[model samples]
Target: MTRIPELLAPAGDAAALDAAIRSGADAVYLGASLFSARSQAANFAAPQLGQAIDKAHLHGLSVYLALNTLIAQDEMETALQIAGRAAERGVDAIILQDAGLAAELHRYLPDLPLHASTQMTVTDRAGLNMAARLGFSRVILARELTIKEIEGVTAEAKRHHLETEVFVHGALCMSVSGQCLLSSLNGGRSGNRGACAQPCRLPWTLDAAQKDPFPWLSPCDQSLLDGIPDLTRIGVRSLKIEGRMRSADYVGQVVAVYREALDRLQDNNPLNRQERDRARERLLLAFNRGGRFSDRPISGQMGRAFLAGSYSGSYGLFLGTVLKSDPVTGVLTIRSDKASNRTVTRGDVLSVRMSGEDKERASAPVGKISQTSDGWRVQGFHPDVLRTITPGLQVYQMGSQ
Candidate 1:
């Protein structure tokens, strides 16, 4: 009779919301247009949000609206109004970053549960106690905590009758949550106000040369797919994924894997090696934006663990190396380790990068494929690429199929 922790997924819009639920999410957190951490995401307008809450409720999934952005002096009314409307729509909970907003919401809508957002940067016992005292029933721990730190925080929260939630998977920022000002400094878009321009994803440079050619500042995405059992055993009430800005396909794939993993753990039958490998493939196809991941943040592997070449965004899965190419013949030879020509699809986009430096690259959609003596010969390389593509370049499939 072990308690299976809730599987929470991100829902940036109506499409992502549907995908999350269909893929077996226990609960979903989403942006409410104005006050979302990911302002760039396709957040829900007020009306759309109401509809979204109803839709998720229909599937028996708890919908937690993200009003986690810091409210401005003149915008307090709008912030309170948004929380009140969400409560009226029967939202299961509201995630809060600003203590003032949480207090107002709790005072006005006492029945609605408030989950303190990771944006609050909570880690220690004192912070958790402060959140509980401020009327928060649950607290989403900061992602930077080590595994040991998390166990301690969870134990303390339990003592105060407060539920603990943590980010088991997804992207990590260079700065701690709610502490980053790089985006606001580089561009006028403030990360705290929900208008982060994601400056961390871009290449940084010194006066004369590029400082970190790769995304050295951007931490690798987290993947605690193997640690589900330990988290639930330690009394972690919810496992949250952090990708409201990602695609529905991405949300669905991650949700399915984590859901399956949680169920298997609950039944005391973890996925076998082959099954785990297959799940990893599904995740790879869905989105592998960053390179390597750690089980916990304090490992200090964030800077060194990034993917090889394409560090800025989704580089998809690396297929294989290009053996040969001919601009005149309009054909390129590719070698895949998977030994499956079935992966070829017309119009499938691919990034061709020099094996040495992933920066020198060009992407093209696959037009046609034929079996060859050595491997599969892909024709119709992107017109811009046919001439420039060189042999021995690594080709990565971008995005999901």
Candidate 2:
């Protein structure tokens, strides 16, 4: 019998929690109002946390509270108190990055399951051994590990009676997991402490006189939906999707696709070519960088293609470039490229991108959409966005309602 791994989804808020459950996640991870890595996310407070846990438990979904930020000496006591509250609220587990806090929490609540965050940078046998010794029940392997490396680590993990979790999908950091100081150096915010300003997503240039800047530090988002079979075969206990800061629609869409894939895998019926292509399209519709997906660590590529310098941030399926715009009526005629298969309808979100620009010019929901002889005729944009519309600007579907 094949051991099916748990499908873990991110729950940044109540809406995301609902999406994760509705989309068929086995477990969901979220953070409290304090000491969470994603401080920008609308995290739950004490009362809200309890309610969220109850709601998830009702659906047979386990909730893991992310106290995964680096705890300073002065903040240790407060962090422990938060852990105690979460434990009392019946959280399935607590994810942590600080070894000191993990040790203290283990001592404080001996039975509470502790998961080592990917921020812990545990990639090899030695790291697994150390994690086991520190009383972590499971370890989230660093995102930098290849599939082969993951298999080796999982094999070693079983020897130490520790379950292993791998990030099957989501954004990939340019630096090593748990070791990035670039955000802190550039700004006062620290990635380790979870207040990352995402400075890497910003543009930079090697040449001082260069007109266009590139996002050299940002890598394409990882999608290992195709690699589920290999991960299951290697005895990975959990498959994680990383997007706590994304919208509920994105979470629901991504989770639904991965859930279907996992279900097929469990039943020994893998997705056919057409089904796989459709799934990839749905994932792309939810969110994508450079209008493509990549298993960067698995492929072991660090070149320009992998870096995706030209296209930064979450730009969904690339529809085409603007051929004409009517600023007064908020109508735009677009000439689509290779995205002929995708259809834009009412309520779908569209992002406008200018040539040689990293950031989006404008994003608006589609009020009306129609296929034209020349191209796509889209309308329902706000008056202000009309000014930004121009010929040759790229357009992408950020999400579909």
Candidate 3:
């Protein structure tokens, strides 16, 4: 059987951790309360982290604690303590951004696997090999890499016997990894250690006249959903998702879409148009920067501009639920269940809601009926509609009925 790429999802908190594992992620990456860069994210406290490790292991998924932020002279002791604690919790790995920190952890916890975080800006074969020599079992390649670049890097990693991971889907950085100073310059928050204020997402201007009228910045979120097949061919071991602040609902939906996408591709079957369309629509609804309606290329003109909107310190989607869905009469039902009604529509997109609280959760689409009968029965359904039906007789729906 062909080996599938490990799907590494983000777990911003205990709930998010459950959501990631429940959504069928092979592993989850998260951070501790301190020494990690995602300060705003609901990081796990030391006790909660040990609990999280136990829970993830019960589900047979690995847990990688994020030690991937910069370490100041005063923070080195705290960082090492966090690493030692993670090792004690039996964490599968610790992702680190600082080479000195990684080396520090390596000497103290030789048994623990170390991953060089993307903050290392591994742009070439030599850089990756160097990381491998430094005791990094896996090196997350920079997001800016092109397909050709990835191929070369992956080959190099193999020659050096190091595992290579990549960001298959997530927010695109405006500057090169470890090279971005925009956030610190603009908001006084450094991006190197993951405290990025995301200045790139904010609108900018160059000329005085156009400063107010024409916003100068916009960056598109990256989606390698379509590129998973090629990435798999290049021997990438893990695919990472971005959004540490996003909701579990969003995590579940995105993970499910990628899970399904990779599965279909692994079978050597092209993503039938329906599958591709469905994945695109789900991502847009989850949260996206402007693009060709979210289904277009991951990066380019408008998409790029949209992603670079502005940094608000905190930016991401909220938790939502499928209030209902009844397929008997051809109408889908939904409710944001949150304060914001971002947008919901028919034919837009729908993903099975996976919850950290309910690992076995599944969803069936509610389609609109073209023809109605004397009662609740509807007619004129497509043959493929069978795929949407679950074994249970009950159909989920929403609306007055």
Candidate 4:
């Protein structure tokens, strides 16, 4: 049987790398400590880089280090140093944005394969050919291309002896891949090299720009959950999931969904329509850019902690415990009897684990709260998950039914 297209996931840090690998990513893409475009990520330092590579390789998954940033004259030496360390660490591939660097690495580290990061804007046959000439074994195509364009590019890539990968799901930039200058221009942050402030997530008044003055220009996050089979059928070599900035729960949920989708499609059949529909619902619930498409949350809304530095562990529904409600304050105080993965919140939707006759999961919204000397009491949306909680065992949210 032909091998299924690889499922690629992003790792902003070491923990996230472990999360992706455990959650079923065939490979994980990350950055070297210094030169990665995502300067904000607590990227793998030089010493830690070897450990990450070993872990991924131990699991039989590939590690691709991102050297995918434009290097100014001053940054060249440092960038090459990072590349050399990654190569010595036994990384499977190096992703680069610059052709010069690609050629340089190819000459110096002849054994290492090069992948053209999307920052190179490899969206068309011409670009693909250019990458091949520069010795890129694979080209991570731009995210904005439609399926037809992808098919065309894939065909051309194959003809040119190059492999093709496309972003199947993730947050999308407002501008074309590798083409956005908004961050560097507006905030002195260079988005091309990964210090994006994510200006797109902010609600902007177009009239303020004196250009197009409508909310209509706001681009929605691109979701190809429903489009996976079409992509697989086109012979794409890999499916990329974007979220170096997302949590483990988000990683697990998305990867599990896509993993199931890919499994169903390997029979040369289209993905089960129902699975895609279900996956879409799950993706929305898992936290995304929400809009007519999915809405990616903006800064200042969800603690914005991610904007400052990377936090690897799960949050929100990750942890919680059974608690008595403070009827007056609407807060659920944890009961000594039960603990949670993280903390229980008012709007949190959770599923209860159950035996026969129940769907095995139920969700509730925190409504009323009354704190007591013994513990906390709280109201719920449905109360099914909360009601089923046993006394001594802490009832936390179940991942999926």
Top model by TM-score, which number? Answer: 2
What TM-score should be assigned to candidate 3? 0.75
Model 2: how far residue 385 lies from native, Å: 6.1
lDDT of 2 at 34: 91
User: Which pairs clash inside model 1?
Assistant: 291-307
Candidate 4 weakest lDDT stretch, 10 residues: 307-316
* Best-performing candidate as measured by lDDT: 2
> What is the Å distance of residue 385 in model 1 from its true position?
3.2
Task: Report the C-alpha lDDT of model 1 over 1-401, residue by residue, as the tens digit.
Answer: 56799999999988999999999999999988788888889989989999999999999999999988888878989988888888899989999899998888878888889999998988898898789878999999988887778888999999989999988778777788656899899988989988888777776654566654555466557678766777888899999998999889889989999999888887888888877767766666666655345554744344455532345566576777888787878888888746533365676667877655646378777778787655578876754567777777787776434
Candidates in order have lDDT scores of 0.80, 0.88, 0.68, 0.68
Which candidate do you rate higher for lDDT, 1 or 4? 1
Q: Model 3, range 216-335, lDDT digits (tens) per residue?
A: 344556677777878888899999988778778778878888888777766777587767866776675566653222212323233343442332221223324433335554443333
Listed in order, each prediction's TM-score against the native is: 0.90, 0.92, 0.75, 0.74
Of 3 and 4, the candidate ahead on lDDT is 3
Ordered from best to worst lDDT, the candidate numbers read 2, 1, 3, 4
User: What stretches of model 4 exceed 4 Å from their correct place?
Assistant: 208-218, 267-271, 291-401
Clashes of 4: 31
Evaluate residue 114 in candidate 1 and report its C-alpha lDDT on the 0 to 100 scale.
Answer: 96
The CA-based lDDT of model 2 is what?
0.88
User: Deviation in angstroms for 32 in model 3?
Assistant: 0.2
How big is the positional error of residue 32 in model 2, measured in Å on the Cα after superposition?
Answer: 1.1
Candidate 1 stretches greater than 4 Å from native: 206-214, 298-303, 306-310, 326-330, 338-348, 370-374, 399-401
